[model samples]
Target: MRYSKATDYALHTMMFLAAATPRTTIGVQQLAERQHVSPTYLSKILTKLVKAGMIESTTGVNGGYRLKRDWENISFLDIIHAIEGSASLFDCSLDHGPECLIQRVVTAAEEKMETYLREQKLADLAKELNLMH
Candidate 1:
């Protein structure tokens, strides 16, 4: 299952946010520059992250975005769900209903993926980034 570009961008952006120092904010322009995307596009992704409670947005001369206090507890699944809304990548369009074997197989795979994602915390990578900086 393929995720959208927005999800990819959000994940990378979040890692950067997670790596940042406490209370320090990164502007959308700067965040977008790394991905070679426009600031306006990244702003929408930031808004989703803010609404998901993974980050906070500030307004003023130093206005930007920063990770929340509980960012260390946020998992990859959390960030993905924030951008993708928990929708399944594949859906059986036939009339087989819930008893479809294909559906069962797909569901099982999705569950396995979800478990792996849920176990991986964003803080894990951020800690490494912090050490390197």
Candidate 2:
């Protein structure tokens, strides 16, 4: 399984917010510049993140966006799920096509991966990132 660039950016964005001081807003342009992503590209990801309640936004001067919850309260899986929806790893259609040998293996792997991701909170990821403001 692979994640789209959108998912990668969303995850990176959340980690940035988590690493920032709580309740402080960061502009999308600033975020994009730091992450080396296009502002227009980041905006699309931010919109979805905000709509999902993972992030909050404001307008006008001194306005930008902030995390909706504490970093410890969020999860990597939550961000992934918010951006990509459910952790559906297998396409049943593949099994329907022909004799698939690894369907069962793939299903088990997906389940294991999902469980690992769910158990891993964003805070856990931050610890690994060591992202200090």
Per-residue alpha-carbon lDDT of model 1 for 38-57, expressed as tens digits? 99999999999999998999
- TM-score, every prediction: 0.93, 0.83
lDDT, model 1, position 6? 97
lDDT of 2 by residue, 1-133 (tens): 7988899999888888876754789998899998899999999899988888888999989888898765577777778887898856677775553356577677778888888888988776666677432
Best by TM-score: 1
All candidates: CA RMSD in angstroms?
1.3, 2.9
On a 0 to 100 scale, what is the lDDT of residue 128 in model 2? 67
**Candidate 2 worst ten-residue window by lDDT:** 94-103
Q: Which pairs clash (backbone N, Cα, C closer than 3 Å) in model 1?
A: none
- TM-score, structure 2 vs. true: 0.83
The TM-score measured for candidate 1 stands at 0.93
| RMSD from true fold, candidate 2 | 2.9
Show model 2 residue runs off by greater than 4 Å: 94-101, 127-133
